[model samples]
Target: MPEYKQFPLADTAEGLTEAEILGWRIKPGDEVTVNQIVVEIETAKAAVELPIPWAGVVTELLVEPGQTVEVGAPILTVDVDPGGAAAPAPVTNGSAPADPQAAEEEMKPLVGYGSKTVVAKRRPRKTATATPEPVSEPVPEPEPMASVHTVSAPRGGYVPLAKPPVRKLAKELGVDLYDLTGTAEGGVITREDVRRAAEPASAAPAAPVAAGARERRVPVKGVRKATAQAMVASAFTAPHVTEFLTVDVTPMMELRQRLKTSPAFAGVKLTPLAFAAKAVCLAARRTPDVNAVWDDSGATAEIVYKDYVHLGIAAATPRGLVVPKIRDADAMSLVDLARALEDLTSTARDGKTTPEAMLGGTFTITNVGVFGVDTGTPIINPGESAILAVGAIRDMPWVVDGELAVRKVMQLSLSFDHRVIDGQQGSQFLADVGALLADPAVAITF
Candidate 1:
């Protein structure tokens, strides 16, 4: 007898409900060891790799790539006792092994990993051999296109097994569900199957669709979906008040140049974002309201203020917008803050940021300046009181010592939760930040 156990999907992060399978590193019959990287999953925050807990020969992959599996659902079946499996056939307790799906599973072969062409297909059983099937009836939809998972239990329907979303996709693509086969888990049809079935007809001659109707339909299940939900929640829940400030940052620019050449700052890549981040931290000290949150989940609603800052830097990555925080950012020196910013940006760019690093942020800075856009009303991140948007710095005419002069100028936009932050506090915090950037020597007053 083969000792088999199904591996259930575990929560990769705090309160994670589901994840989309990105890829599988192993196939059926492949020998795997404990703690071996098996599959990569994309959660609400970032993409994460999952490892198996037990080592054994792969008996079956229950879920195909691109399927969104809920936490605790079994995804893979492993044969832990493969070497001790040369025994007699199983004894059924009054249950016959002649069931169509059960018999089909026994005869199924191991498919080459990621091979879309090889899959299990079970025909609709007929009552008699002489009866002819109808010609108008279309074949059932096939499994997922990524790999051969399993043939679902024998079922009779208008077409092969397909989920509701898959059926809707087929209708949108003008594909008949009866024309294709499923390669997904339990022979369930997936969005990929519909897209693949529609490709031939699209290349032939697509119907007069509104431009790009059949272009692409990316499933919103990961970071993109999370961001959308957060944005909508923040926009509707938080009463946002935005204020703008334009500053002549000639002194700050000069300081950066000198610091770059200085021995203490050598080999460090300091950017304008680093300056804005530092300024936010400094300004937060004088006006703690910007670093506060309205906690309503407790027994009594309260406005909670923190002494230290968990500064979040909003970064746009290939995956989506991720805001990873720098813990205790206000306690660090200018050099340390600059280095942390560099590392955070690097990690976010590589899409390796952990979900834990993105939590518990007290404030955020969004540097829209990198895109050369001049200031827009930014939305405050959920759970945080305020957000700062820094715009592009350019040489602009300014009055210095009663004379017109071209100086490095930049714009700052602050959006704060009005419930926790009064207009005076928001204006004061924005002013303090602008003051620090306009004159680097103002730290002595703070």
Candidate 2:
């Protein structure tokens, strides 16, 4: 049979150029079945497991873990036919009569790959002629055991008190398996239990206690690299102007409470963010100038007007800030908008948010309210003309209907590229958004 070779990294998705090999599920010389997870690839969006398309014995592992390979790169090679498929011959070591059938049975392929061959060499054993001094004291009683396979009595048989994933988490966190009291069903270790035990309160922080220590080095790649380049370009090119307005959003809060019980908004969490997003969408309709982007690339240099509103929600996660957009947000109802917000936030948190989800935002909203911040002028995300910063809603006494009353107030900060949107247009946009938040019913009038 002719041997056919597979190329490295094959395009798994449209427009996908490169992917990093996260790990391998199987090793070389293993007989792989169709649909078996061979390797994992981290794409621009998420980490995905790639299955073997054909069943065969893994002949070679072409790539190593943590290596970023381009699309169509061959990661592994499989031998469809391992020649005659005859078992290796058995031998007698002069101890007793050998069972050839038993030896042949052992050599048969039970699963992927058989045992690998490694040459063994004998070395001279070291025996101290003179007794040496004690190296250290005996291990303490409270010390945890070094191995999981060697469980003592009453612990029961090989069921291993920890679930596979939980055990993985414990290993990653350097948590001692013996010290953790497994709360999982039937004495299995759970993820939550492991996580709690790994917390700073349970154990001291991992960093050395020395003062002015060196910082750890982490390679800046993927989303972080892309974000840095975009931010630098935007900050340098756009002449930014920031404007802030404090508004009494007591009415919007009341509206949210009332809508929570309405039949139109069942199974949805009504949040101030939803109200703010809706207000921004509605306001953009009146002042399209704020909704437009500056495209001076053309000869005449004109402001490009986009009739549709792609509302960008700036979310801060472990991987820094990511702005994922909701297309045609103006066309969606309050309930649908809330659902979309939840989806986008979840995706961003999981690091599965796509670049497409982050592109083509005309206007953006950053809810600094969650972080308990008063207000700050947010930088405009690349390709977007304006960004709205929504600050924390705090209860403060304000003049309402000619009377002093405790009301919920928040600061709305708008930063726009002055070159694209003039101060007059930007101010009008902010005023309209403020008006909607003041009385949500005003949005229906527009």
Candidate 3:
């Protein structure tokens, strides 16, 4: 018989204890190559694609998609035959195959590799044309209209059905497969279809939720569980002092608009978040002291002037607040930064951010503007000495060229560990970010 091997989930990153299975790429009996993306998983930090480590034929899937599994758990089973196909079908109680068609159907690839039935449908037949009626003028033929069909199971039925997780996603977005256009192979519904349905139309109000909804209880695990423990410990152990700075951000907004039309930023989303991030990075360069670490055990201050920018973007997810760091933000162009931000935000919103994505953030930027709030004194994420909060941009009266004029303005709040950064140093960092926003041309100087 063919020897079966189990591939357990590996540690995606440090501090990640668990992950939710998003979906599988291959089915049972399909040959999978090394480094082929066979599975997609969501960790606390972000949704990441996982590649198969060894080349082999898939034998079994151990974990169902959408199931929350701990790190090191068995995820799938594979038949590793380095030489060639060696094993024969096992004789169950020495019984022989009675129905060949049933066996052939069983051998077909299912989503979980024999876990469920593939959806199938029937086909239509040709029809004869009616005899032409005796008339003086010939009847005009009707023009063929384009037919838009919803995605569904194949004519033979859906093979390799999506796991429970994908179904759950479909339900949350209020998507009826009967109404959506599927993009999966052979018209099978995919998770992407559900996501597309969730997007709200611009200028249209969002659908209202059911009144008096019951609270959902999700057991804390993975990156979310780790962040919670660290936050509780930090909040009580460290002294946090948050300061605010309201500035006119009209110039930064104007710069973002112009960049979107530029050849370099073509096809990239140039938003206020990009400007806020750039301001934070530039401000960090000016005041290195704000990026220091407070070592309580050593009873000394460690001011770190990081050579590279590991800027963390704070995301509020359904799981919890997770801060995933974008490594080497300083090396990224404005367009690249915007793309990264979009990807990171998408991963976070989907509850797939992994643990490795959460670690090693030198500084963090949280946008409270998405919530429509003016400003907030945000809590500092653990291990990081400082965090900057970007508030909603609003039009208000302000002094422009010594005259009171209406202009776009926003409030920025900075929170720091008092033990490491003094008030003067904190103020300087905040001032620098504000200055950069007031005149984005200063970014070129840096």
Candidate 4:
């Protein structure tokens, strides 16, 4: 008679379809209070902790950790009204419990146990004339199971001792767990065992379009999977046009060196990327087309231009490439931009960037310069029109006023969606950004 409540996996971000259960805070039979942290999940954007909406006793965890569940699917269940009525009888073939003792005896053991040998007991020979049919003819053994999900030999098709996600991973990698013994405690097969079994096959020549090979086959599931899908879709959907510019930035470099000792910029990790970020914001004012989106879903093709800039800084982490935005970046002072960039990047590297922080980016800047690369033709993010790739700032010989001199120089590459921004607008925007980086003092005129 207990009222059961199922907790579904909710969409943590816009267009997020699924998430992998990272861990559980409570188990079956554990008491839980409302607003208690129940589970941690990793979505496409970031990892998030979910809380219980109602107080209850954890009745069951429908899904195990490492299993990816779709949005709106129930991951756990609870008995919300456990004290209001009698405990529900054990469900066995739709029949009710025969007695209170039987119900009490069967109520426990909610957790799974490993399969044991099912031995058949024989009865003593009776005083009958018929010779009791000898306990012979032998008990027929089970056949060899073709799949890894089933245990082989004496256990027949009985379930083996492996976690659900481990089993899932084994099957995907084509590893036969029945033949390979697990190295885990109690001989429970793990993901490492499965991958080890698949090692020989992984070394074989990969197919033309295979996603993995060369000694290891990793299943793309989390951030890597999401990034690949997004980039592919953006490349195919948007017409990308990349432009480049090289500028002598001696003045800007001198200013940066001077600002390091300034009282206003004290305690701030002012970086060259921050200067590029500020430049992008100021340049967008003259070329709003670079900040617009192509809205083809409407009745007719329309361009939606934004008044403010949600500047995105592309950060590479252990997970994947994530672009977290600083909202209203154009309104911030140079010092404020420096502080925001520092915090945003550190949070991203720590894998703590929230999904909301990655959304609604109007423009993106990727510092390839950090890797000592010159420049790259970056692909535009789907929702935004432009992306700027900052190249390595190096000392090179330059001609200043028809006189040769050694100065600091940097390269900038801008990729934009041609459908929204014309060639002229894109060129002007790129030039303006280069001008700002070459001369930080030019920002006062804007």
Candidate 5:
């Protein structure tokens, strides 16, 4: 007899209640060590790898890929006995036993480890068996005539063939998938077909779809779902006030070019964002309200002012939008800030950002300029007072010493919680940031 231990989902940061199973690193009958990663789970914030607490042989995986599991639910069962033999490989439904070598090769180790290659083998087709002949019977004739306008239901017990996402869309729209004719390959139902079926019969006729018309339905889960909820809450709860400023950033651009070739900034990818982040941190000292939070949870409403700057940079990743904080950003030099930003962006892009990195943000900056957009009113992150949006920098006509000349200019939009920051304070803060970028030398005055 073997002792079995169940592994439940651990409580994560931000009180995430559930996570989707992205992939499994270990399968049944594989031996795992203590603290070895067993699966990758995507939460509303990031993709996290779960490690087994007790070393054992994996007996069963209770959850499948793409399944959303609640916290404290048993995801896997493992045999904990040290001398217990590995569990026998389970047969797949409607398939032959997998090759032992192939199974062994497919089980890759956790992150940062090299994976072994497994050759793909096609399943052998099943052979037909001989059957006896059936006896013939007389068929009955129709008795009465029905209304001409009456539509009959689809014949046979066949159901529509559709992917999970398409099925979800049909369910949400309350459409009968079986009634809609599939337009995709192999007569499979698609998202567009469901949408067409969902339109009201009394409404105007929809325009004809062009050839090759297609649609893709992506599930709003994991980071994307969390981001949506946060944005909605912030937008509704915070009385936001947006202020815009156009700054001549020629001096900052010149500084960036000079820093790139300097020995002090070797091997670092510097960008305009680094300068913007520095300016925000420096100017935040004068406008402390911008870095403060409004707390009404206690007996009385209070304005909490933060002395340190935990700057957050909003990053758009394949998973979704995430804001990872650079702790103690006010204390770091320009070079240090650049290096920190590089690491933060790389980690976010790889979807390996930890939940802890996303907490304790005092102020945030979203660089929409990277996408070639001019500017956007970014929502303030929850628990923070303000957010800044940076726009594209282009050569524009500006008064340089009373003479019109083309200079590098960028647009900056700041959205602040009106409860914490007044219009005057917000305007002054925005102006200070603009002045810093317009002339890098102005930062010394602070």
Candidate 6:
């Protein structure tokens, strides 16, 4: 006789209560092995693959794809001994089996299950109708509803058909996909469609909607939900003071182009961000308070200063905004820093950033210039004391040697925790970063 085992949801970090089943790898009756991936689940942080711990034949799947299951809930059942003859069906309605061994076998322990004894509780079966009622002859069939105004994706609720990246973009922009009609094949929504829908009514070039169109709601979950909670907490708990600086980055840009042609930086793709990151690390040496955190939870309030810089780059991924860190960034050369930034951003954009990579960040930098924005005061990461926002670099007229000349200019916005850093220290640190970009030779003085 084969014993049935129930698999419960595994515990996750941050006390995530539930996870949505993204997909199932195996079906009922299929043989599975130990450590085989059984299902993919999306929690509040990342998508994780859950593996089966015991070899068995799948008996039942208690949850369907796209359905959210709570932690510790039984998700699937399996029969352990497939070769053995099938045991008699267990009695329904909470009745125990007649044979003691059969009853004990049914209560066998499974992975993620507690020591509590398992009991089978079945719902009452519905009675089957034996005879069919006769219908009136020549009954007229109602006309099918028009396709013009009908939503064909699904009935009762609309689930937009989009890849994870597209969905992430829509969530960040606060766009509702249920109201927009997809133009892609098979009614799949594309990223462009979501961006268009997010635009204001007057600026958007889309066609007008019907008068009675209904509104749609999308629940915030996964990375977006976690980011929201952290931001709210950080904003209320920390007193932020932001400082801005605009500098001519022509020297830095020229140096970048020269480095690109050099054999020393052959494979590294150097950007202005790498220069800014290097500058931040160099400036921190003079003003250590900007790199420290304020700890007030303990009995004695103190400033915790870090000796090394674990630089964080704010990256927007298909999963949401994630800040993956580069370990010991202050010790790296310019070329090495560029390479690390390249790999970090690429990995984050692909949704492959691990939880460990996002931990232990000492300072952060956000490149709003990529989105073509001038500059904005960025919020500090939860554990970090300050965040630097880099704006778009463009050609602007500037006075050089008492003569007007075109120079590459960029804006830098620094937001720091007021508890850890005062206005004097914050302004000095911002000035040092700007001075480095204005002339890379200033790094030698550090």
Best by TM-score: 1
- Distance (Å) between predicted and true CA of 377, model 3? 2.1
* Model 6 agreement with the true structure over 284-403: per-residue lDDT tens digits: 999998889988889999899999999999998877888889999999999999999999998887777766678889999999999998799999999889999999999999999999
lDDT of 4 at 117: 17
TM-scores for all candidates: the values are 0.75, 0.67, 0.64, 0.73, 0.73, 0.74
What tens-digit string does per-residue lDDT give for candidate 3 at 1-446? 35444465655665456788767777666788877888877776556677766677886666666578766555665666745675543334423223445333333332221232222111111223498458798764432211112123343443334445656666565666556655777665678877887676788886677864433444566456667777788788668899999999898888788888899887887789987887787777878766666665566655455666788998888767788888988777777789899898888888767666777878889999989898988777777788899999999999998999999999999989887788999999999899889998877776
Better of 2 and 6 by TM-score: 6
- Of 4 and 6, the candidate ahead on lDDT is 6
All candidates: CA RMSD in angstroms? 9.7, 12.5, 14.8, 10.5, 12.3, 7.9
lDDT order, best first, reads 5, 6, 1, 4, 2, 3
Q: Model 2, 230-299: lDDT tens per residue?
A: 7889999999999999999988999899999999889897789998999988888888888888887878
From the highest TM-score down, the ranking of the candidates is 1, 6, 4, 5, 2, 3
lDDT of 1 by residue, 51-87 (tens): 8867788866777666798766667766667868544
Name the TM-score of candidate 4: 0.73
lDDT by residue for model 5 over 1-446, one digit each (tens)? 35455566665555768899777787778899988988888888888888876787886667666679876566776767746574533344423226565344223222232232222222222333498446497543332111111122234635466664576567677677778778998788888999989876776787787774445456788988899999999999999999999999999999899989999999988889999999999999999999999999999999999999999999999888999999999999999999999999999999899988999999999999999999998999999999999999999999989999999999999999999999999999999999999898999999
lDDT of each: 0.79, 0.71, 0.70, 0.79, 0.80, 0.80
Whose TM-score is higher: candidate 1's or candidate 3's? 1
| Candidate 4, 1-446: lDDT as tens digits | 66555566766776777898866777778899977988878899887788877788887777667679876666776777787886653444434244555333233211121122111111111124455566757844533322222333344444566664676677677777676787889788888888888776655886575544434456788788888898998999999999999998899889899999999999999899889989999999999998999888978988899999999999999778999999999999999999999999999998889888999999999999999999999989878999999999999999999999999999999999989988999999999999998888898887
What's the lDDT of the predicted structure labeled candidate 2?
0.71
lDDT of 3 at 329: 88
